[model samples]
Target: MTAGMPAEKSMNFGPSARRLLARLSPQRGQVLAVAALAVLSVACTVIGPKILGRATDVIFTGLLGKQFPAGMTHDQAVAAVRASGNANVADMLARMDVVPGRGIDFTALRNVLLVVLALYVVASLLMWLQGYLLNGVVQATILRLRADVEDKLNRLPLPYFDGQPRGELLSRVTNDIDNISQTLSQTLSQLLTSLLSVIGVLTMMFVISPLLAVVALVAIPLSVLVTRLIAKRSQRQFVAQWTHTGALNGQIEEAYTGHELVKVFGRQQEVQAAFAAKNEELFRASFGAQFVSGIIMPSMMFIGNLSYVAIAVVGGLRVASGAMSLGDVQAFIQYSRQFTQPLTQVASMANLLQSGVASAERVFAVLDAAEQSPEPARPARVTDRHGRVEFEHVSFRYQPDKPLIEDLSLVADPGHTVAIVGPTGAGKTTLVNLVMRFYELDAGRITLDGVDITTMRRDELRGEIGMVLQDTWLFGGTIRDNIAYGNPNATEEQILAAARATFVDRFVRSLPDGYDTVIDEEGSNVSAGERQLITIARAFLADPSLLILDEATSSVDTRTEVLLQRAMAALREDRTSFVIAHRLSTIRDADLILVMEQGRIVEQGTHQELLAAGGAYARLYHAQFSAAAVDLDEAAAAGAGQVPAGVGPRAGGPRPRIPAS
Candidate 1:
């Protein structure tokens, strides 16, 4: 947990692969189609070689038929057979043979070449079809993989997001999955092609000569062993490669988000060094995986050539004698090459397998993470009615051994406002977070409208509570859209009315676009004060039965504070409002004010009543008085607006007016 970083605890491959397969379920038919094509291509490959071998055998016997002796040189045997035939048997024979065809027998030679041409054409077409279909499944599935990952991210728990880096997650969701998808597209077809070729070669070899067939397989086990070892090592390196890539992404994201701070601190060099280190780390790891896996293909090819040479040396003598025909030797050499082709292919694609699995693993991790538990087995609906809230013996903490809130309980009726005052880290936000169901309580319960808040659907409960934060969070959208987000179905007049309630209409009506202006990401286009007002108006538009205003004025200027005070008063009328404010002046008229310390309520009362009691509330009130006076004095020196501490024209006055028909 750096100053700002999210952990990669949810990274895994098992769940992701399963999810991928499920999504690719629709494309299984394509896979089967490709498989059928692979089988057909293999058939062509085997049959083509067999036909050439038969042609060789027929030509050899034609040249050596009924030789003068049982053993003779190829030329002597042709002389003897030609003596009997009354013509050059070599011419008749070579013409029938594909390899030599010394004197072309136009008909026989043409047939062999034509058959070879047909096999090549058929095999190429099948391979092309297989590649096209497989690639289609791979890329399409990956796009869906990214979409699903994004959806899961949207649903993940808030705590899951806290303290995590944005860049690392982006890497997993984008780069890693993309690498996997690419590997699948490039390797799957080649893998099947290589495999089918091997099978076809082996079967044809058996048909040609069983003894030579066994010799060709001598290197198969050795190749598989080497491949397995290299593949396992590659998997680890691929995982490391992806992890480093994510770390680099996290660093870059953080640097950009805090670009101003980095610039001010003159830490550009430092940032560069950090990024370069991670970048190099990824490079080294990926290089290791790729370099090792790359060795497998060439090594298998070398072994394949060696096996072919050995088969030729051994099978050649048999043909020289009366034991074999020239055709058997030719077929055996072809069969020997087949042994390593598939091995070579799988070895070639080992990198893709590793990277793909690594990325899918990371994706699966997020998909596998436990989501925020659903609201309940059966949820009670919340209607817009009385806003009665109670916290009964609620004890909660974000972490064990550090209680943020302990045995805390309280209640407020509808049409009432509750002000909760506490020092920083007194669990003010935690309390409201519980109410928001952002975190579950360790003990006790909270109720709304005479029913446990937990009994209501999470979305439905949130729909009935409006929150206005100190640092107002605004999405990039039009002014009207931001205000209308709370009630997307809201009419234009309803949005304007909501804006008016929070005095947001004043600024918005002045804009040239009125309601169509586009805001930057985080509403950076608007002033901080105006952003707060917009959020307040958004909450007002929601018209929830309960309102939660957390740190509503902590980070704003004095003039902005004044605006917030007005918005708070107007918005709190006729609603159940919980205002967590350190600025005592803002919540002075609360129907109930609870002064809290160390997660426990030390004092509870009306404003004047607590000031008269001269306890926690009195101390807080006086402390803020001096602070407000100091702030006002500072503002006076700087020519700025200020909020008067205790009493203004409306000090100790009745509640502000609520909108009525």
Candidate 2:
């Protein structure tokens, strides 16, 4: 269930590779243009060597003709060489179309050279155009892929985010996608050009001299063997490299996020040790992948050299025997080089392709994940927002085998304050979360104003409620901006009113920037109490019909809590509110008090009525007051110059308490 975790199973290269290429399908027109250009470029390049070979023939024939006796016909030159007992030279002379007593024909040579130069120029221009178009195609494909991933993130359920490490998920979205872009940018055009060159060059080699062409073919099997061996080994390393990269990023992010806690707990060494281990793993993986794939190019070149040596030796014998002309031999050698060069290029590109595909697989896994259930096609509307919430036989569990809440039911009537008090893991927070639809119930349904919450659009249901949690969240923005986040269209007067109502304005005026004060990235510039007040102010601005406060006053001082209580009482005038708190004094005035134990309401009544019943609520009420009484007694004794045994002045004073209502 952990997101972006490396799969324990081996990578399926074929399917993933095919899927990666399939992403290019939308750019079919651009791809086709690139391919056509590649074909034309390769064709021009292929023909260049043959045309130059003709120029070589013109020069060679003219040079040899000058060595013959002046006025001697081509037939006489061959006959004279035969009579001179040089039969090999006679055969060579017979094959060559040489004019006796003639020197290098500069004009013909110049004209052939011009044609070769023109072919090369046209080929270069076409190749450049091909590269430009291919770049656009690749960029467009990656752009679509990035958009898809971003959309997928929004559709994912909360549980998906809960299970995923932030850094690992970021690595998948940002790092993995970037890797794919680089891979395509480096390989696509080169791969196409190399493939086309191979085909064109091979065809020309065969046409010029089939025997030498056959010799060059010997390198193909050897090259394939080398490439396959290296690519197979490197591919696993590439997968490992990216996997470890994600793991290392997760570790680093976790470490940095909790850096303050690490120092406070003196666990810096432990965190560093863990980081080093993951870093080492990533290093080893990257090195192995690079080193293995690095072998392909040199190994291919070695195989090509072997083929080149064989072709050269054989072509020389054929030329000397007059089975092939000097010009054809020269052209065949050039074609052989062209053929092996592309093969080597292809072999070298295997590793890059594999690395890119590895990243593509990771990105695709995110896109392929299961999303939250679709919203209702015909969503039900809550016409009257009275804020009456009812849980009808609701059952839920984080795990299938271990139920947390089963068949639990409750109702919070409009304009009433419902306070829930419980021990840890008693499902106090879970109750409010269900109301907000953060999670789906396993059975039964929650209704808002007599309408099933499931039938309403999630956003529409949440829009009617406001929430404040124990862990305050403040982004890096001015105080005014943070407050306005609750209601984006709130006027300046409303923002100031909410801030003053929640006691935020009192502190804001004391700061140099007042309401314009900027919160840092961590919001560490503000005290915990100040941050909590800001969140409360934000909720106030929302002015929702239903409010859920989870330990909203836990971080504030006793005086501030008392002030906030008065502010909240006024705010809750015509709205329903669910307040989860451990402080019994804060909830003594609630219209209904629910004492929950093990996900069931063990006691339900007004605070004083529950106390009269002397059940779970009574025990919880007494437990909190008893602890505070004990601390107060100790502090009182110390003030009277009578310190308890083994106690010192630094033992601290009585804990802050909210006055009983």
Candidate 3:
């Protein structure tokens, strides 16, 4: 139904199918070659039984020549055969022993057997070639499909990823792609060969005896009906199974990613219970779909066997009635088996085909999703070094009706630090998102150096700005690599200098591998403060004209914070910077302090000026010290053995309290 969602109803095996086929257009020549080989393979196999039947007739005629019938002379038997008017039997009799029961025609039998053997060998070789070529074609098509999906992922907007589960999206790119590969590599060729066999066998059967052909074909409708009914019921279960599996994958990803938090909160049992519930749902749906689809093979086999028995019975009757030769009747039975065989095979594969198509539909849905609007045909480049930014009456909302930032306006002049402080939901991070153009505004514009950012190429616009987010992100790499991430081409000297500037060098030299040590994902092996330092170092290496530090010093200790402040002061001396921090003391000396509330700036001024005004910023600044004072009083009261009226024993001078048994 949507990107990152499991396929719902079975895809229309129509235009979407054609579109998938169109993807294979580049390999059309190879496809045609495989088809030609399949045709030859089917032809040889279909002709083999007919030739074998002739050999059987040859043996029968040899036996009959030795012993005609009870009292029948050779002449009478020949007359009877002539009246039957079968060319193959006549031809076989001509080569057999002339005298009655003289001897067997071993030489002729050997010749016929050789031809049959050669036919089979060639057919087998052709089949092998068909598979070999088809594999190449299928893989090439898959390669293109995978590339297209990867390109689509890069082109999609951030909101697309924000709404979809990473695990579900991964399933489409990996699991779904693999499904389509399996189907094309194996099922597609098999389906073609089976259909050809069915057509060729039917033609041969009719030529042998129209009545027997009719009897053999009775299973077609019956098998189709059974398979169709079961497939209809099973399709929904298949969809449900895939959907639950995706959900389960998402749950596993979240649980594992937040495993530390789960342990801290003692939620192991809760997480296990949730996983078990999702797993059970997946199992139920998978079992139902598999079990129901599994019924097709046996049901088709039963119907096929019924048809086989009828053809044998009726064909034997015709042979006895002199309406057909022994060879024709024998070939007819073989053809009857061949006809029902593909029917049974196709019936059994009904669910597999359905599933493959569903996977293709899911893959196609992602490819077809609306991509981010293209860059302007003639894009402007932001090359100004002034770092002047202005948000001009910009309005934005995650949802349309509930506006987060309505007609918001702000300006950051060159060579100044703008420290933004606000409550959690007061649109603080949104400002960074807007500046980077991660999302487009609903109305109005944002400008850099008085040039509208929307007109500039995204890469050119972002090149002038650098960010060190509150969440320090260091991918799996050596410390040197992480520090040089913002400037991949940075020299060893530059990297070391940035590290020293951020006070990161203090810890780097103490590590076992120094700058060469590899960190685990998310820098989990390092302390939070160390990771923050590395990110700060990375940003410093970039040395952009505009810097955004969103709570960059939040995780560091006071000593590290003081060092960072010194480094930042020097870095921000002649560069425009935006700093969002909760600790008022961190941004007390900023050139400008903007206090926000509910997406609106309630106060904007220097720290001293705001404190003098005694507005929102002043109250917030005083509140922090007041809360600290309250904590100190409680601690002092406990040390004095003076229990406050509502205080517990532990808060009353560390008194001995009864431990819970």
Count backbone overlaps in model 3. 2
> How would you order the candidates by TM-score, starting with the best?
2, 3, 1
Model 3 residue 70 lDDT score: 50
Better of 1 and 2 by TM-score: 2
The candidate with the higher TM-score, 2 or 3, is: 2
Task: Pick out the ten consecutive residues of candidate 3 with the lowest summed lDDT.
Answer: 652-661
Best by TM-score: 2
RMSD of 2: 4.2
Taken over the whole model, the C-alpha lDDT of each candidate is 0.76, 0.89, 0.83
Judged by lDDT relative to the true structure, which candidate is superior, 1 or 3? 3
Q: Of the candidates numbered 2 and 3, which has the greater lDDT value?
A: 2
Model 1's alpha-carbon lDDT is 0.76
Least well predicted 10-residue stretch by lDDT in candidate 1 = 95-104
lDDT per residue for candidate 2 within 276-361, as digits (tens), equals: 98888889989998999999999988998899899889999998898988898889889888999999988888888888888998
Which stretches of model 3 miss by more than 4 angstroms? Answer: 1-16, 68-74, 78-99, 632-661
Clashing pairs in 1: 5-163, 5-164, 5-165, 6-163, 6-164, 6-165, 12-361, 13-361, 16-364
Error of 3 at 653 (Å): 12
- The RMSD of every model to the true structure, in order and in angstroms, is 9.1, 4.2, 4.5
